[model samples]
Target: MMNRARITRVGALAAASALAIGGLTACQSGGGESSGGDVTITWWHNSTSDPLKSLWADVASEFEADHPGVTVKVEGYQNEELQRTLIPNALRSGGGVDLFQAWGGGEIKDQVAAGYVKDISDAAADTIEAVGPVVSGWQVDGKTYGLPFQYGIEGFWYNTDLFAEAGIDAPPTTLDELYTAIDKLKAAGITPIAVGAGDKWPAAHYWYNFALKSCSPDTLKEAQSQLVFDDPCFVEAGELLQEFIDSEPFQDGFLATSAQQGAGSSAGMLATGKAAMELMGHWNPGVMGGILKDDAGQDDATPPEFLGWFNFPGIDGTAGDPTAALGGGDGFACAQWAPDECVELLEYIESEDVQSRFGEIGAGIPVLPAAASSITDPNLQQVLEGLQSASYVQLWLDTAYGPTVGGAMNDGIVALFGGQGTPEDIVKAMQDAAATL
Candidate 1:
């Protein structure tokens, strides 16, 4: 029988709607070799927030100290920007950063198929085993192309104080209960949900979670690999999302709000108590903590105690299990032509000591089992429990489907949120986009 972690290896989607704006072309065939003497490993990651950002710098410095004649040059970019633009451009250009951020799904598969990423199976075998099967998203045909350092599940991050104000005694566990809570919050003059629809992927997550509840695992798996969406559940997901929209649960002008930007963003809304809840992954606390500030606009030393979480509610009479979940993790992959030290740096990042420190600093939900004990945040602990107990985990839909189809699906979902599209529109868009792939 497979281990618990192995059973939890299910994949999730990523954020990259920019592929629709400007096409993400296939990577070129060949890349230039790294320079010889005085080697430098260029590492790029999406750790723009504090502590984690500084923590990465410290990790790089430590690596350089241990290995003579090598320099680890690290650069950080915002998550959406890095995934949607920088990384895609680098892969197409074929000779840039040595190691860059990767989510390991259809995206990495595209890079691997195009010969843009290296196969690190033999090079980092020990580290791969240590990380365990949660790295499944990073593998293709049993060959490892990247290493996942953080893995987690998605759920609703709520403001407990606000929930009490709205008279919601307990978090909703079913679709009917969720709608009731939304109505109650509205009656109490509160914005029930805060969504960053300006960033298309955030809005797309709504449709994705609904699909997870509506479709069977076998149906979802077939759709991921074959891009087939003939199942009625696909349309059912859109209808469910539309019903939620009809309840007017989200904040006003949500379409203009970014996911994680400033005080006006979705994360900011939750942090500032402007909204009651947000649908986000386990990484929410770290990002939310970074953006939270005092009256003087300086970073707050303490995390918001009002922050709480609950699983996405299950739809009644669905083929999907209520225990099923949707999520994925952050990983890094070496460029095809990066220096040998690139693999070494990957191994170093996943070491027990570093991963434990990563958890201690609240960087993310560490994938290393030994480091699990270091996680003290109750909100993150809730996410960990959900991940461990999930009947089947599904990767983010966009991530599971790759760039072309994923991009189209995101655009289609965003159109629905804007009141310009319908359930059939999203299904048709996906079907059309899949035909190309």
Candidate 2:
């Protein structure tokens, strides 16, 4: 596999890397068309909550209204379940799913290899071109397999009111400072950070951030291309994670907490002011708002007025560039066997109007270069500013490395979080998985 290092900026949206891969078995779809010439394409995505959930539903309706005979059966599922199980099973059987969430990276590459995804390069060329290099992750070789709608770096989403109550003045810019803030928050009887350990990926991201700060850009590129992890920095990432875990900054019972499931999940903790901060992505504000809406049972639910964001603090001494960031986007792809309407629906989803609405509501960073003006949300604006200043931006480690190796890596990282694994274990796990490929 070639190193997909070529990065391009899509207006304000930064270019991000791709996702995971896996071999899949083939079968037939449960349904796609009726005998009367009516087309029904099933759409599956990870936005079971409000805001994004409603946005997607409305988009589906608009698509149906424009195309008289076409029906889009859109549904939202939990992210992990959708990405890890349902979609893969549907694809393996060639049933149920027509258009589904496609996180660009090694994941789509594997789907392409299995001949399960449509080559949308021709069908959605205009939208792809409009999004520019930011769509890099969703492409395989040189062809587009999927298209991203949300792309931005991960950072600390904090409750400003809680920060003030804890007597923390500003966001930390270095590891030591973050530790100090953590101490202050703890002294003030507050949980400093919320990690959804039960989900694995959320807790695993701590090591991902540490690796971003510990490894050099060249080392990361070489490792991804060669699937090698001999460098000591990889182990140091786990060491740093272990130290952070030792700090015990997360809330109690965090190991079983879901990331965004309900009012008790990680995002829910931050949304309800039960926690001071959460390390999450640009789309988190939407997730938080959706959580609040669900928990409060009110239509006027919005992200906390005192919500704030800051980049993950840099470690004082590391080979990794302090300016490097970790991020990626969410996109969609058409099943290889789906009707042509599948691609048309993708076109509508990435259209300027739809993308603009995405930005306006803080669902995520819109991919369209022209949709930048629609973002009035201050937190997302801060994220874009950080993206502009970042000297390098890496896709989420689990995503950039693809599924097989990334899965092993996360497993090891989560083990460390639970005090059952060591720093070396995580690197070894990744190395072992890479060896198979």
Candidate 3:
């Protein structure tokens, strides 16, 4: 759910005009009304695995039991498929979903502009207040369109046992130490990092972290608002990522490897001890746990142990604060034609009790401040701590910048990884796309 870009004033005005028109058309089409007869709210989410899949179903059933004549139909799809294909197609057609998963940054903004989503500010006001500032990602012009149930920062997830075997005493805190650790891991015949470059977004994350190291929060914000990448740091991010790529630190056939699929995927490699570490969001453990299950779907006896986390190492001469972070969250938004019940469902999911349950199950780092105590996983706790202490948290590049620029930036980054592009190429790709905006 992470991505990139800034938008120009002209582009902003254009988008705003489109949003107003779309909103008007949506209202004219009876967007907020419930069908008079049996009402079925279609919920689309990307939790295609258990226990999250089952947890969501259970929640839906509970909601259905409490409300007569309302049926909740929950559908699950793979993350990439939903994001890159299903949701886009559905939104374009202006149907097919009532409540759908939303990432709450530029993606939501784009959807809002296209008139694919509804503004639930008044309906979810109490929930928004409880969630606090984290909901800003889902707001446009100070109006809420969605509610975040889970949020977290990205970092390296490493195997303590692997680090020990590589003769590393502690997680590296600086870039030099990180490179040293990478060399040491390689010397021990272990893949230093597990990246799913085949899944372009996972590969794009490396460049994003480098940007976080080289650009200050204010500079990033300015770029986001203006859709401009005039700063040298943006290209420097590409250069830094290229240096890492040249180290041959990733798994073999990494360009073809998926990010979170089965045993051959990046998370699978880390879970099954085929690699030393992976750079992923707070959701890594749940994905890894899913991969570690036995044939009968029970937890494996040797499920990943001594799992640890560390912030992305800082470069020595970077302008950005070392403590700044890159991250975002998962939320649900109602389609413009969805019933009022859709908003109710979102509020139900964000309630403190439900969010606490979500934390207890390690679904993700809960967005509810009070649910922080319910988090028991050590690795997730580390992510939570890093997020709370960050000097500033930049939304994922592709997400902050919206689709066009973010997609171009991601393509350019993966091209660099594949040795098909350069740092300048990455910047050029984004600049070119921004121009269109």
Task: Work out the TM-score per prediction.
Answer: 0.91, 0.92, 0.91
User: lDDT (CA) for every model shown?
Assistant: 0.86, 0.86, 0.85
Those runs of model 1 whose alpha carbons end farther than 4 Å from true positions after fitting are 1-36, 294-298
lDDT tens per residue, model 2, 249-336? 9999888888976688899899888999999999888888877786756576588788999999998879999999999899999988
Q: How many backbone clashes does candidate 2 have?
A: 15
Q: Against the true structure, candidate 2 has what lDDT? A: 0.86
Q: Lowest summed lDDT over 10 consecutive residues: which window, candidate 3?
A: 1-10
Which one wins by TM-score: 2 or 3? 2
**Candidate 1 structure quality by residue, lDDT tens digits, 184-245:** 99899989999999989999999999999899999999999888999999999999999888
Among all candidates shown, the one with the greatest lDDT: 1
State residue 150's C-alpha deviation in candidate 3, in Å: 0.6
Residue 119 Cα positional deviation in candidate 1, in Å, after optimal superposition: 1.2
Question: What RMSD, rounded to one decimal, does every model reach?
Answer: 7.4, 8.4, 7.3
